[model samples]
Target: MEPGNQTHVSDFLLMEVTDDPELKPLLFSLFLSMYMVTILGNLLIILAVSSDPHLHTPMYFFLCNLSLADICLSTTTVPKMLVNIQAQNQHISYTGCIAQVCFVLVFIGFESCLLAVMAYDRYVAICHPLRYTVIMTPWLCVLLILVLLLLSTGDALLHGLVLSQLSFCRDREIPHFFCELDQVIKLACSDTFIYTILIFFVVGLYGVVPLCGVIFSYTQIVSSVLRIPTVGGRYKAFSTCGSHLSVVSLFYGTGFGVYISSAVTDSSRKTAVASMMYIVVPQMMNPFIYSLRNRDMKGAFRKLISRITSL
Candidate 1:
């Protein structure tokens, strides 16, 4: 059969995370558990932040959005994998695959942008405490979120449209559990030069820029904290940033690991496994990192739970 454009494509086969039939049940259970944890954990963060009037600041506002994004990002991938595992059918419809690609990009892009926003929030709170409320007004915060959503959705749609144009040969098996953009592109028989360029552009615009923002924000934060003179003051200021810093490290560290693994290793399976580190682990850990390290979050959660129990 001749290579056909995406229009003629009916579906693509998603490769299982593991090949062992014996391990299928284990893998299914494991992923299901993780998905549930990710959803519930992130939901709790949102509820805690929203329900508590004390938590209605810009930082917690962004935290709520971040939790929402994590929930979305995880939802974009995990549920399909669970369904495939249970059905013992790794086939994903072409439309479903394209939709997955679009959403994965959108949510991940939103997360990158949101993290940078959160970093700026910390910078304002620590470095310019007096003007923080003025600078990060409610309107400004909402505008930032709206702008990030536009940027994320626009980029995702562009990539999805470009991807839809590419033709594929008979080999339609994606080595990853879901329609990871890069993996899907690799299977295209058509020239992907434009798509490749767009990927790099989006990466720079969404990925590197946010990372730079986080770094700059933290740099100023450290400088301002150092000027506090008193050790307790310094410690207290730095503590506010600890949770965000941990999350930034986890997000970027695993992300870079995926890039490095994909670049250096010839094994697609290994690359897929590395992708899991970035995709699965951080979403599961973010709620814990924030709720445990953050006194406000812990108190909010307690209140939220008590309220729920009483209801």
Candidate 2:
């Protein structure tokens, strides 16, 4: 009768690459296109940032990190699913499955922390314009990124280590493609109370906590923008963070929606689709989000194009 009171099914049967046996061909082709776009789009962002010295800034630094994380995140799941689809066998070894779960969690954590850092960077740039350059110095950006790497390293390892102790026996089939964290935990032969508790804690720390930081940063930024004397100045100030803000909204909104979907619904198909929005779609969208919203990058691209043409 109620939502939280609803029982969670122990395991989900991964619907995998296709629902329709006949549509398998079409589905494979579509997913292949999406996966290619995700990898190529994200990789280009990394390349553009690395080769273009003028694009080196705290924003671009974090953008590059996000691109790399997206690449890793999508690669960990989609490729395996594609292989399974192509071969007509979607079963993953327990060990291979768990490894996928580990990396997905790690990369998700990595992206979460990176977005938090980027939010703070924008906050500093907008709220403290005079100190923006000094505050977000190249060394500081590097250190910030290094800190995220260390944070993700621990976050990913902890979940995997905890999951490693789990014994799977009742259900070997994992619902959805690749190894999802919740789906893997569901298969554990051991009591999942501790695992469930740990999931809540980690999700809160790695997911909800960063949401608060992003909100706080934007709140301060909005306050600073409101104080600007001219309309042009206020809009100009807000414009700087528009792309990142849109991306943040898209990412967290879709992510939390999946969590809610998995919570309320019992269907594996629904969960699989919801998961794709955050896990796969964002990988494809991240490069375009930055490219269209940020002006500096547009200028950098133009100059890059001009120089190459001259050569």
lDDT of 2 by residue, 42-103 (tens): 77777777778888778888898899899898889888877888888877765677678888
- Candidate 1: residue 310 lDDT (0-100): 100
For each candidate, the alpha-carbon lDDT, in order, equals 0.91, 0.81
TM-score of each: 0.97, 0.91
**Which prediction has the highest lDDT against the true structure?**
1
Give the lDDT of residue 276 in candidate 1. Answer: 70
Each model's total of backbone clashes: 0, 3
TM-score of 2: 0.91
